[model samples]
Target: MHRTRRLVPAIAAMVAGAVLAAGTVSACQADQKPEPEQSAAAPVVPAAPTPTPLPSAAPGTAGPDAERSAWLGEQLREIVDAQHFDDVVNAKTGKRPPAMPNVDVAVIELDDTGRPVAAANTLLTQKHPHGVAVPVTRDLSAPGVRWTHWSNSVWAAKKSTEPLLADRGDAPLEFMTPYPASVFKLIVAFGVARLADRGGVRYDEVYDYRPRKATCPDGRKPGKHSVSWWLDAMLTYSSNTATCALLMMLHERDGVAPMNGALRSLGLPTLRVVNTDPADGGGWSFWGLTMTALDTSRLLLLFTEAPGTLWRTPKGDPVTVGVLKRSSRATLRKMLRDQGLNQALSTANWCGQDYPAQGIPHAVPKRWIDPATGVVHVEDRTYRGDVRKCADDAEVEFAHKTGLVPSAGADAGIVTALPGAKPRRYVISVFSNLGCTYVDFVGAYDGACRYTEKLATLGAAVDALMTKTAGRATATLVSGG
Candidate 1:
């Protein structure tokens, strides 16, 4: 979704007011009693006795999952090679297939030591993501076993990269943008998760935040709510206020440099830490956190992985803050199912419902369950463009976030294909603009959903690819261990 810096006072004011209203903060009551600042980094526990590596599952049934996993590495390339995935844009449609236009894919395979093993790339119409390349003679077999750094790489995405930024500390990956929460959220989430371990805070307890009233920059009442409230807000709602509050907490703990440091740890070589808060950081400036499709998948995987790395300060001191280890991982996943982020959906207000809050009846065949209340819904609202956006509805359930800006309209998120059958999940991120209007391109108002549907199509294709891969792996007969 296009993260427009523009503020809609009506929505902002409502949220600020709701924070102090107490009753509306039903999720959890904030501790009105303030406490002294807690500054100590959570004490790190010594690694538990590294149990002698558990004997690899006796290679018996189904060709070892490892072989299958390994085979997939090659198979993926084969799939890319085998397909007539015309790297050409559809002249009639101007649509780029296989990889998006001006996109880059950075795959980092880790070794047994949690260090980088293999870093390969399949660039689209370029040398590196942003015209920067540093070739290294990397070993695939000796990939870093410590997945921590690898996980962090994906979490940071294309923004701030340092360690792996330049080939020889020179030609670095130049990101002329800020880190998007899509990437930073995972980094920060990792930090929080590790902190939870030290503070003995439960994942469920994290949601126990109350949006206590505070001074907001726009001079709204109670200004804003507590940072804890923002945890859920950012994770579920992607609230800017929550992101800033969390950033404030991080800055207090590690200073401003840590944010940049985390970016460097990953090979972004470009992520920047804004010196000032967006509210106070001058009107409408960018923080530069945009990332690619692959990076997005990586964050999802790391947060889902057990024992992932969280963050390390620029001083090389590690502060256990990755929340991936907590019960909340599952908590957050369930929250996703409950439509946690669906709060905005209820409001029927993206780009102020510029176009198709709901979708064209025949256009969008999807489902929506109220995150606040488990209610199925259909969005049929339209704004800015007076034209009817959604004409009809199909039986399929589709719940996703939509983005629109000048010539760049996108929609990304999970789709529950075959709603009854496990909601056979798929992720889609589409971007396109054909005959797009300026307003549609600026704040991402291209209501056509042309690119959004592309994402939907890509997701469906990937799911099929993975499933087919799995089926072949499972079907292969094995005779010996």
Candidate 2:
């Protein structure tokens, strides 16, 4: 992956402005659970006066920044293969990789923000074994620049923290995607929240949201949901209905960036809704993208901040603690809180591939089941084929998302400690697409599993690879493009 991002200086500038969002959060304020803790992520790492520059920008067209980022990505690739983590599992059959693949597994380490931290050394992390992944033909346009991800700024998140924006570098890497509409959707949701803040409306008092529908005769007298709850459904739950509903609520509030309030307050250079589909695809996504692990990694880093960015007043001043009660970012983040946590996006029915009734041709191989009912709280069912059972025996806890289009497939998420992982924490994201027909269940799974499986194996490799690359540019990044 080769691309450039001017993160250091931008991140460095927001220090003094790092105020919390005001008192705009409506419900579940007290119920907010801390983000799942792994060895504290890179977010905790204070932004330096300037960020270190990335090496690569895009392939065949990098300047200094691009070269560095490319160098970094290449280095990590080498490390993944240094001990042959690539072969830790078969790229093709999902079988174990060759003994050679097992030879040089790369090291994955976490930055202060608990993000994957690796050495900026090496070309591609070399796999101890040969590259056996067969190339598949697929379509998708050439990589184009686009916003791939954005995070809502909340209260108490330090201003010195990184900016709430990131994107795939202009450089083209294999399978990198620009910011998808999901990023914008969330951004719009935040916009609506800001509008509410300005208008003095509260989420709990407006639209309501729930995973299970409320009972009502003819659905006439059922209890209602709040707008914030709907916003949560749009985000954490990725609910299509909630997303569309929330957009409608903010039609009068949003501006050029999608949702509402002054665009300058949110500080988002890119965060606009282009589609409102149940699948979160369509509209702006058609532009093209080239996303990378690093790009997504950056987004993960940004989301860990506080939620007060939505409390800003008309003057862009802080309205609450831990966030600026008066800024656009505060209002934006608080808007999400209006819906509170545990909405449809974060809470949904968990049906594994065995559900059988949906004929959905989907199977969940991973899940974070509820402790009370032992039911899956987060079911990862993107995998097609017979692999539906993958999650049944998993020792590690996994939170995953999978996507597929005719010639395209993708999966990304985090894999935390299972019973067997020595260190017990990993974050992985992968995407793949080809110019061919994905005829049935197998294709659907192919579209998704490849990304997930690669991420699963690769994330583990990152753990080991970075451990070996310390202070050494010659260290590996898992090899094989």
Candidate 3:
């Protein structure tokens, strides 16, 4: 079932890229039915720039005149190499993260013009290289980076298999990997805000969100919510119901075509959103979303980077049109900061909880529907509890989104080196599909869970790397480790 559904999006992505390159997207012609309009209170504001064709370099290399980028990449390479991720085991669970995990990582500094370039490096895994350094703004392409048909550069490998070009040497890696859930919320959030920036949608307008697929927390029906309310609910709480409503709204406003256009206009061709509606018998809800670590890092920069550094056109011309407005960026940042699902990447920021020998039994509550009555019931149960790893003292604020399903775990965000700390910032995006198919929250949250622990370790390492580079002697990185 999953494989079949996955194929649909892959096919759609191929077609969408083709249509986009021709300067006419047939998908945008999504039955122009009468749709609700934005409230009159907010005015249209065209903001920043258009997405442009980026230059490409080989994995683990930088563009012209980018020595700093090379150094940063080297720093990131050392951090990942030190972990020995593949063999690492959680002491509590006594389980490895993934016998074979599909993973991709991108780390790029955001201090400069926000052009992602770092040292070229790769990690050797028992199965394959843990990652090929396709620095966000460098490499990952041939003949240069083009948004159209970007998938041609992807390095798709079966578990424990090497890339076909591994022996030949020069292979441009594609960071745009498919994610089942969670991480794509960033794209959804970006879509809503981008539409608002273009004046086609307003955050203040109210929309009705009916609960259908997932059961409500207390059997409460979700009624009408403002666009902003729904955005907050979808982003902060990871609410599928709210996300459905926003997707419906985007579909009604001429489908995913507009959002794709906005993405391309912003210099991200690898990032695309397909409207997969279960009501249309699509089988899955958010599984149609796809993107790369590099693209995600670039997208996050739009929220925090100076306007001049955001984006440019294919012709190298300044793009003042179709950019995210300042107001929208602030709102999105606030939503990210308020994210409730902080268990993954932010795990390093949490203080550890000591558990007794009994292993801290925990009562887990869940709401489910009976097949016979279509009614929701809450089941309270207890299970072996997990202990938190000791938090790090790396003083940084991570405003980001996390995506997790049994098959995958990911976190992407902007890491700010606390206020009054010389103003250092960077972006880190990670997606690891460890194939941990836990059926329930308790199983997924088990203290020794591989994905969770992996995320925490990666976050901590990156945090440490950032701290070490800051020369702690002069900068006051607040103690939050």
Better of 1 and 3 by TM-score: 3
Arrange candidates by TM-score, highest first: which order?
3, 1, 2
1 or 3: which has the higher lDDT? 3
Candidate that scores best on TM-score = 3
Q: Candidate 2: lDDT of 345?
A: 12
User: Comparing 1 and 2 by TM-score, which wins?
Assistant: 1
Off by over 4 Å in 1: 1-100, 104-122, 126-164, 168-183, 200-228, 255-296, 305-323, 338-451, 474-481
lDDT of all predictions, in order shown? 0.30, 0.29, 0.46
How many clashes (backbone atoms < 3 Å, residues ≥3 apart in a chain or on different chains) does model 2 have?
141
Q: Over the stretch 220-332, how does candidate 3's per-residue lDDT look in tens digits?
A: 24569899998987776566556667776776676468778877665566566654543321223222356666667767767763433233444444433126788998899
Off by over 4 Å in 3: 1-65, 88-99, 112-127, 135-180, 210-222, 278-287, 311-315, 319-322, 348-350, 354-394, 420-423, 438-450, 471-481
lDDT of 2 by residue, 337-417 (tens): 332111111111223332111111112322333434444442232212233233343333334333322222333334344
Candidate 3 TM-score to native: 0.63
Over the full model, what C-alpha lDDT does candidate 3 score relative to the true structure? 0.46
